[model samples]
Target chain A: MDRKKNISMAVIKRLPKYHRYLMELLKNDVDRISSKELSEKIGFTASQIRQDLNCFGDFGQQGYGYNVKELYNQISAILGLQKDYNYVIIGAGNLGQALANYTRFDKLGFNLKGIFDANPKLVGIRIRDIEIADIDEMENFLKSNPVDIGMLCVPQTSAQKVCDILVNGGVKGIWNFAPIDLTAPEDVIIENVHLSESLLTLVYLLNEGK
Target chain B: MDRKKNISMAVIKRLPKYHRYLMELLKNDVDRISSKELSEKIGFTASQIRQDLNCFGDFGQQGYGYNVKELYNQISAILGLQKDYNYVIIGAGNLGQALANYTRFDKLGFNLKGIFDANPKLVGIRIRDIEIADIDEMENFLKSNPVDIGMLCVPQTSAQKVCDILVNGGVKGIWNFAPIDLTAPEDVIIENVHLSESLLTLVYLLNEGK
Candidate 1:
């Protein structure tokens, strides 16, 4: 945790990429991995991987590289993937439903406790057997069934209001899909998933002939 | 184009964010903005904003700051948003449908040319007036109605195959939503949108008590 505070956000962002690669390696039954090998697979440079991992601790030996399974576990722990986290979707729109039905979350230990929406037409609909509750019921639902995270998929107009509801309802973190930038109290963590940003980045890259 | 080739990927990634903030300012009828003002609003440092903008050319005057509309247009051109690019979604699942129905793309000059699905039942279903075509017809469709980009929303198992088809069909860029690392030819730009990576980052922040 002390090491985490000292790490840069750039490095923190790459940890999950490392985790994903390590998971793939584990699935392939590879017990060992060199920085170069991992780098070739993930696109990040070998030196950058070493530097990022060193911020956490000396997980890799000088010559032995890294134990794939052990490193995977360590990275997972550092990423807070060891603990089971419950989350709820704030909007039952297309984005919200896609996220609710995203099968990977459950495999990653994130339990979808509920799915809520402001639209009367959407409320009560089941996405993967999880019923979409009314936005008005979010507070009560959160109180009775606490969740660590809230996935905000509401439109930009209603994002802040829905975010506020989640925060007040005791959600410690928010994964926002709305285009709007949101603000929250110091205690609440917010990670904005700007889909368009990725698309624009691709556009720039393509235009550059990369 | 020469300046773009020299710019770092990190800087390129933030271009869309700067564009977004500038758009917001424009919408509010704000005509002029300073790096300091933008920094405060967007969370990047004033110096960083200046540095980023300087990569393309001098857009900000020493004392006069920047013309909001002009700067926005400059950034948009740099992001290739100035040109109209047609894109086809290769998987008409929930994510694909959401992206196809995403109204913001058309505003950004990315026209939804088509949507395709391997599922026979899903094929021909209309999303936002654009019919979902059978994946088998993708090659034929791309031949007749060529698109600049292919948005891959298929499962991990089929991502690579779908991507190959897109490339063979002459698509220049790929915005992949599948949780797989896809490979493409040198001319084809690929941007993998790993949704779980963002979630894990949120989890890490939450557990760190941020």
Candidate 2:
């Protein structure tokens, strides 16, 4: 199984969708899928699917198409889902609690190690058996129990501060839900889910006719 | 203002980010910004910023640069933020509740008129004065209280069914939080925030070196 280097971010972003569709196919006991059939289910063009899958490796035969389980497993491996990732939520606000309770991430091998918030009232509260700890303990917690990812769900004002703590504590990936963008070092990866910008974009598209 | 038609989706997506940064600038009491300075702050190339802003109308002078407030207001108008958008959450689970509690959306004129849920316990619960009603009441609710956007936070199984109801009830836009890709009419815009896919992308990037 030879792999290709320098896969484009566009293709990397689409790999999860491919993984998801393939998983659905496997759930329904589908054995194999032609690129055309996969395209119809996944909404990408057949040629685009072929090109994207080819970026990782040669998965499909000319006429035989792709093996469902084989493709799913390969994409999963490509997505780094084969190993479990432990992460701690920095701010246990509504968004933080929502993410903590989102069971799908856990199923995808992402574990919620701890949750922290500055609010005194929220301290000691539990979400899915993980206790919400004091914000001051976060750096110490990270030093003792290192994590691969840091889920930043704090307010924009404090987001960068908490992010600095996370990065300084040696976390590599940040799944940020704050509306503001944070500056980070070269080695650390930051993925932002800017909900306001998303809502604004939706509104823009809704009124694009105007 | 001479507004251009058929702005590319790439430009549309970037408009929100520009709006965000300009808002920050206004909050900081910055009155003007040159394209080069704006580019450094916003992480886009100066030429790219000039091109994107030009898609709407002439706002900047060659050396005088852009009036921050003027540009911000223009982009807000372009994003349709000047008008209030009424929306309802289709499923008041963890994510739905979080959206309901999000004050930023309210500040941006996206009003939460209603929240619907299938769970009997959640049906009568209130988040910020808006009560969660039975999911069965959504169609009737939509008939009387028309909404601009339908936020789908339901499970994938019920997403399409609820989406169909929202569309049939006359929603023009959908902010879907459900993992599945929903099918809507050409006129009905759907913006999906697929958390699992986003998380997978982060994990994949984190493991890109492996």
Best prediction by TM-score: 2
Predicted candidate 2, C-alpha RMSD: 1.3
Stretches off by above 4 angstroms in model 2 are A1-4, B1-4
Q: What are the clashing pairs of model 2?
A: none
Instruction: State the lDDT of candidate 2 residue by residue for A1-210, as single tens digits.
Output: 235368888898899999889988999999999999999999999999999998888898999999999999989988888899999988887788888998888888988899999999999988899889999999999999979999988889999999999999999999999888889998899998999989898999888766
The C-alpha lDDT values of all candidates are: 0.89, 0.91
Span of 10 residues, lowest total lDDT, candidate 1 chain B: B1-10
Per residue, candidate 1 scores C-alpha lDDT tens digits across B22-48 of 999999999998888999999999999
Estimate candidate 2's alpha-carbon lDDT, on a 0 to 1 scale: 0.91
Candidate 2 lDDT, tens digit per residue, B1-210?
Answer: 346467888899899999999989999999999999999999999999999998898889999999999999999998998889999998887788788889888888888899999999988888898888999999999899979999999999999999999999999999999889999899999999999899899998888776
